[model samples]
Target chain A: MSEALVDALNPALFWEYRQVLLRGLAFNAYVFFSAATVALIVGLAAALLRVNRAWPFRWIGTLHVEVFRNAPDYIMVIWVHFVLPLLLGKLIGQRVEFSPFASAVIALGFVYSGYFAETFRAGIQSIPQGHLDAGRACGMAESTILWRIILPQVVRRMLPEAVNQFVSLFKATTIVSLIAVPDLMYQVSMVTQQEMRPLPLYTGAAVTYFAVIYVVAGSVRGLSERWRNKIYA
Target chain B: MDAIPAIRVVDLRKNFGALEVLRGVSFDVHRGSVVSMIGASGSGKSTLLRCINRLETPSAGEVFIDGEPMGGPVTANGERKERPLSDINRMRRDLGMVFQQFNLWPHMTVIGNVIEAPLRVRRMKRKAAIALAEECLARVHLSEKGTEYPARLSGGQMQRVAIARALAMQPKAMLFDEPTSSLDPELTDEVLTVMRELAADGTTMIVVTHEMAFARDASDRVLFLHNGQIEEEGPPDQVFGAPKSERCRQFLSKKLQ
Candidate 1:
């Protein structure tokens, strides 16, 4: 048991495959950034729809949020990778296939957008009606008021919640490995199979994820808090 | 031709479901004149003020600003059509409003709030807007605090910033909706002082207020609203000193106490 513990703790195997693992990690970053952008834009749209005066728009926004938020991430990834392409192919009368990376990004982006939508909506609702009234009283158009007055405050108010969602989004990127996107997890599993030693490979993968998430999330939260204080103080 | 009254309301009525908030209320605010509306809590003073700006659409009657009718053209049958949004927005620019809560945008510095309307609505040059904003800030005695955010200001200071923001628009008239009600006594005095200065400057103004002293001292004319109608209206001396209506007299005794 002592020998196995020492072997699992050794990170020599992880060090040996540094080049390939680093490349795989870079892929994870790419997917995270792309998905984060998608999530932010779509999430804001959904939130606006939910708050729209028309019932049809509100219902559509509600349906989108409920369907995506409740769906399991892994199942979503697989469905986007396989089933979605087939459905699209049938509709368009041609073969439609998404790359594993594309599927991973799309699935994760949409799922996270639901959570972001709620956060944005809460931020928007928290604004005093008096603020909107002031904007209108000054003769601002509705769109101008939204962009100038509403969105700026909403962004500040939603930062902490959005940061958490972003962290969760980054962590969720690991799920892409099952769809054969060459993320850090997929590289670790491949190295494990080749080396025929699960202990060090899996342990190394877990540690790497923990270290990256901790450092990155901690820095983002700290920086954002400082910025908020500087402005709000 | 005689100059048009700055604002004229003809039998304005507003109903929230079955509850009638303003029942055939009518009044005129002439140019450079100050009119103060005083009433009990539910007497629809705020509602009437809101209706003047079309923030609350009137269920009946019409408002004419500078002799131009609000809402839209009145058809032969006297039905008012909805005006284009752009037209309403353009008209609203002529009316500067200050609220009780001093609704300054939190994310902006004081100058930013003051300059936003001038820059956006008027489409003024940046330098011109800044110059105008500075002048307005100076008018409110907040020239030194232009860079500070609204959160850092005291209640009195924030209300002054709100006034500066409204003044930047160079509006035809100013509307005060209980502008000092949210402040403490000391802070309230500061805002009322600024208002008195504006009134003395011949700025057209319509004020809805619970401050009987302000209504009595600063107004050219005082209106006493009771149950959604103007129960009494006259010069402040006539209305406050010897009200014709018994209800107006009773209401003043409670507020003044």
Candidate 2:
């Protein structure tokens, strides 16, 4: 096993594998942005629903949260890849433009949005009633209170959890390789097919992922520190 | 006495469901005197102050602010009539209020909390509002702490910042509902000091306070509320020093508990 691994670790292999990794980053970035947008919408919508005491809206929010949160991200990816376009489109009776990249994000975002929504709901409600009263007492229109006072604090409070969700989405984007979007893991598989050495190829992909997430961790840590200082100053 | 009453409430009645809190309450505050409302818990002192600012609408009757109607109207038969949002906001801007909880925006810095109103409602330039905010902060002895956030400050400092935030709006009248009640005894002095200073400046403050000492010292007149109505109203010396109503005596005595 050691010899097999060492034999695969050629310098030529390193340089050749580098471009695949770069392509992986380019592909994954789209998924990351798409998922981020989707999760933000879902999370904020869920948070608003958490405040809704009305049965119908709250139950709808609840059903979204429960079904999405409990289900695995990979399974959703498979369903989006296979079933949704045909079945859901037929039900609606119109043509829908759904890309593999777009569908991958929808699935991951739907899964993680449930998690982020719970986080955001907790953050929003965790604010003391005094804050809302202050805004109302100041004669602000209701929108001003939410935008300036409530949502900023909600965003500040939710940032770390949101960053974590992004990381989760990034890793989960790799699952899209099975659906033929040519993401990071797909690049790894393609390289392995040519080199015929799974060891070096697996090691290369792991490093690329490790590098991506390592940078993410650093960026989020920096952001958390900066935000904490401003808010806690 | 020719000066118009800054606030006039006549037959004001408010209820949260079956519980009638302000039962036919009537009072008038002259243009530039400090009036303090004192009562035991649940006696509707805070509720009355809130009604003055229209934070809570009256179930019946009228509150007139600087000769303008607030809390809107109720029919002779007592149905609530609504006011347009724009008019209500206009009225609210003319009357600034402080709360027991201080309610400073935690997301904003001390200066941001102070300048928000002038920028939004008054539409003042950012630079001018910032200067005005500093001036207000200076009045509350928070000049050097403009960059500070509420969560970092002591309770006393936070409430003073709240007062500055209210004052920066340049309202005709100010209401404070148990403003220092949330502070510790040490912190209460800091808040009351600002109140004393505002009173000296003739700021026309309507303060609801449990601080009997401040009531006696700061107010031109003190109204003792019992069961949502003024049980007694007179100059502080007469009301607190020489009680007329049986309820007033019981309330002051109960404070000894």
Candidate 3:
């Protein structure tokens, strides 16, 4: 059985399929990075809007969090991929479509932004009221206070939670492959069907994900440690 | 007639819900004079100081700076009209306030705290703001600690940094609300010494303090607050030396003990 297993897991096969698998992994990387970046910005905007003095903005921000957070990621992604473009085309009288990658990114970005928004809001609230009073007493405008004092402290304090959110977003990238974006999971499925081999192919995919996660965890730890001293000081 | 006072509160009143913290409080601090407000805890001394700059809105009455109404208009019905944000900000620039807790921006270095308002509010050049910050820190005797963060400093050092941050704005009058109340007995003297020098240099100051010595020595006038009203006010020589009000005498006797 060992001999057969070794023979089945041939180096030649892996060498031949390396380019396709690597391309799929690269595509996964792109989707996760883009979605995570957009999620961060949208989350920040939503958090600020929720806390803003204006009634409309606060309402809109609350709606964003409520709608997206309660919905499932796969269902949202499927709608973005299939239904959104058709709706837009019918409404606008133009054939509107987003590429599979774009649809996946947008769907996942919105879904995760809701969670990030709550995390950021908690961070902002953790700051003492005295800090805001001090800023105002120094004659700083509200916008200046938010930009110079509040946001910097929030970002620093929220770094650990942000890392967790990014990791979750990275894992969620696998769901994009269901819409045929040819990410790592999609490649694994294709290779397993073509080769009639499940064990070695799935093992390879698992190892790839583990490696990426390990690197991410290490990098986040290093970055967080370096900031710990400077931020609270 | 007399020169206009730097700060005057006319029949100021404040309420937190049904609880009235200040009921019809009034006082005046002449330009370049130091007036000490001494009272037991919860006597509305801090609330009165805060209302002077509209940090806390008054439920009634008015605050005047240099004899001009400081905040927004009062309607005929007596509701306080909201002032334009820019106008409120402009008013805050001329009135510096130091808190009991020091309230230093812990994320910023000492010089950063001192220079922030000058750079952002006054829009001074960075180099010049730094120069002015250094001067303010020197005035508070914290010139060497400019690069240190607030958490790295002792409570005394942090309070002095707070004073330097206020002084850097070059405000017309400085308000000290229990500035030394959170410090050690020895540390209190350090802050009071800097304040004494500011008083000597003829800066208009309103200090809410528990330091009887500071009230007696550094202040030109002393106002004793009891139950949200001025129980006694006179030259410190009279108020502290020969107290007339029974409330004033009792409060002083307890404090001195």
Order of quality (lDDT): 1, 3, 2
Model 2 scores a TM of 0.92
Model 3, position A60: C-alpha lDDT score: 95
Q: What DockQ does each candidate score versus the true complex, computed on alpha carbons?
A: 0.72, 0.51, 0.65
lDDT of 3 by residue, A1-233 (tens): 69997877655665668888899889989999899888888998999888888999999999999998888999999999999999999999999989999999999999999999988888888888878888888778989888888888888788888888888888889889889999988998999899887777777777788899889877987878686676464
Model 2, C-alpha of B198: deviation from truth (Å) = 1.4
Listing every candidate in turn, what is its Cα RMSD in Å to the true structure after a full C-alpha superposition? Answer: 1.7, 2.6, 2.5
**How does model 1 do on interface RMSD, in angstroms?**
1.1
Model 1 CA lDDT for position A185 = 91
Per-prediction fnat: 0.68, 0.48, 0.62
Residue A166 CA displacement from its true place in model 2, Å: 1.8
Question: Looking at candidate 1, what is the lDDT of residue B240?
Answer: 93
Model 1 agreement with the true structure over B90-181: per-residue lDDT tens digits:
88899999998899999899999999999999999989999999999998888999899888999999999999999999999999999988
Best by lDDT: 1
| Candidate No. with top DockQ | 1
Task: Put the candidates in DockQ order, highest first.
Answer: 1, 3, 2
TM-score of 3: 0.93
